[model samples]
Target: MDLILIRHPAVNIDAGICYGATDVPLLCDAAESARILGERLLALNVPPVKGGWHTSPLSRCRLLAEAIGHVHVDARLQELNFGSWEKRRWDGLDRALLDTWAADLDHSRAHGGESVAQLALRVSSWIDEISRDGRPVHAITHAGVIRVLTGQLLGVPRANVIQWPLDFGAIVWLRRVRGEWLLVRWNA
Candidate 1:
């Protein structure tokens, strides 16, 4: 089964703000971004998935999904919950708390949000459920969700996954064959 994960386009929020799971709006024109993404996918020989596309319930993702075509919204695909950090600039947060979270990448909840392990578990569950159907799937979601899903699929450690920089509207492609997942393309 082929899995295509697309990150939402640039958001309207100012730079450096922690807007995870904040349900923000997109910065780019949804239709135009979708059109460009569609062309890029076509160039890569990626056709629409056999099953319909899936999107996070957030408008940032939902609008792009709608512009592309039909979609089913799933809350599980939503961005990691930043809790108290939502809408706050990262640099403005307590340095000690940030350090503590960084030290314990998998288990820390210093930001009062979902831990890396928690996000990974949920994303893994979604991958497991979708893989059972053996149909190609496309999901429009956040960078954090995509990172977690990709890390889970590739067996990458949580700390290492953070090194992967997924740009706005980036696409990551994966395929599951005989119970093993393989990365086909990334950041397309």
Candidate 2:
């Protein structure tokens, strides 16, 4: 089974804002971004609309998914909930709270948002459910969701998963072979 996770295009929000699960709009034209991404996927021998296509409900992802073609919208694919911090500039957030969360990435919910462990649980469950069918899948989701899924699939250390920086419109490929998940390509 193969899974291709594509992060949405750059959002319209400011660079330093924390907008996870905020349903923000795209900064780039969705159609153009999809076209470029489609070409790249084709070059890699990955069909742009292949198999069970899915997208996060947020417009940043959903708009691209619609531009690409048919896709099932799922809330499970949404980014980590940032709670009160949504739309707030990261630099303006309380430094002490940020440090506390950074100190315990897995357990801390310092922003009053979902903890790293909680996000991992939901993403892992989605992975499990989808992998059961042994079908190829393309998902238009967020960076946080992609990070959690990658960490769960690759057995990445919880604290270090954030280091795997993914740019807007990045694509990650994974495969499940003989009941084991393996990373095929990342940030493509």
Candidate 3:
């Protein structure tokens, strides 16, 4: 099975603010980003999947998915919820809370939302459903979701996966062939 994963366009929020799971707007025109991405895919010889785009319910992803093609919005594809930290500035948040989260990054729900393990479970469930059909899948989602999915497929250390520099609007193409997961077209 093949999967084409694309991160949504840049958001309008400031760098210091924590805004996951808070539906945010894109910084640029979704259609424009779609146009450019479509061109890039063509250059990479990645043909469009007939089933259309499966996207996170957040507008950041949904809008771009609509711009590119038909969209199937799925809540499971959403970014990890930050709960009370939705729109708060990271620096202003309680230091204790921050430390608590850092202390156990994978298990802590210090912010009252999903832990890394929870995110992995939901994402894996979603992907497993797709893989069952043995069809090429195309999706637009958040970096957090991408990180989880890539880490699960590639057998990378979770800490290192957390450090992957997936730029906004970047495309990641992966495929599972002959019982092996292959990373292809990551920098696209």
Candidate 4:
């Protein structure tokens, strides 16, 4: 089975703001990026919104999904809730908090937000439920969600997952072979 994950395109949020799960609109450039990504998926026989299992619950995810065409909104696939950090500027955050979070992502949480482990549990459960179907599935979600899922699949530390660097609207395909999950392609 193949699980295709794609991050939502750029949002219309402010330049330095953190908009985790804030339901922000996509930027003009994001619309263009989504169109291009959709074209590429079509070329790959995976055309966006093609009546398969392509699913997402994010507003931006839904927009992109509908643009390509067969997507369903699945709450289980929603981005991690940032709580108080939503719609705030990252630049204004306390440096001490930032440093501590950077040092230990497992226990880190934005003020009134979720920890890395909390997100991992959610993403892991969503992946498990989908994996049980044993069919190909495409998911349009947030970068943080993707990072957690990729970390789980690859057995990498959560803190280092950001080092993988997922570009806006990029695709990462994970396939399970003989009961072992492996990275088939990343940032496609």
Best by lDDT: 3
lDDT of each: 0.88, 0.87, 0.90, 0.76
The alpha-carbon lDDT assigned to residue 1 of candidate 4 equals: 79
Candidate 4 per-residue C-alpha lDDT over 23-116 given as tens digits, one digit per residue, 9 for 90 to 100: 8888755456666986777776652332444555677787877666566777766776767767878888878878877777777784668777
lDDT for residue 70 in candidate 4, whole number 0-100: 60
Query: Which 10-residue window of candidate 1 scores lowest in summed lDDT?
Result: 44-53
What is the Cα-based TM-score of model 2? 0.95
Clashes of each: 0, 0, 0, 3
Candidate 2 lDDT, 52-130, residue by residue in tens: 4789999999999999888888888989988888999999999999999889988899989899888888888787787
Provide the lDDT at 139 for model 4.
83
| Candidate 3 or 2, higher TM-score | 3
- Check candidate 1 and list the clashing pairs: none
Off by over 4 Å in 1: none
Cα TM-score per model: 0.96, 0.95, 0.96, 0.87
Candidate 4: deviation at residue 6, Å? Answer: 0.8
Write down the worst ten-residue block by lDDT for model 3: 43-52
Q: Tell me each candidate's RMSD, in Å, in order.
A: 1.1, 1.3, 1.1, 2.5
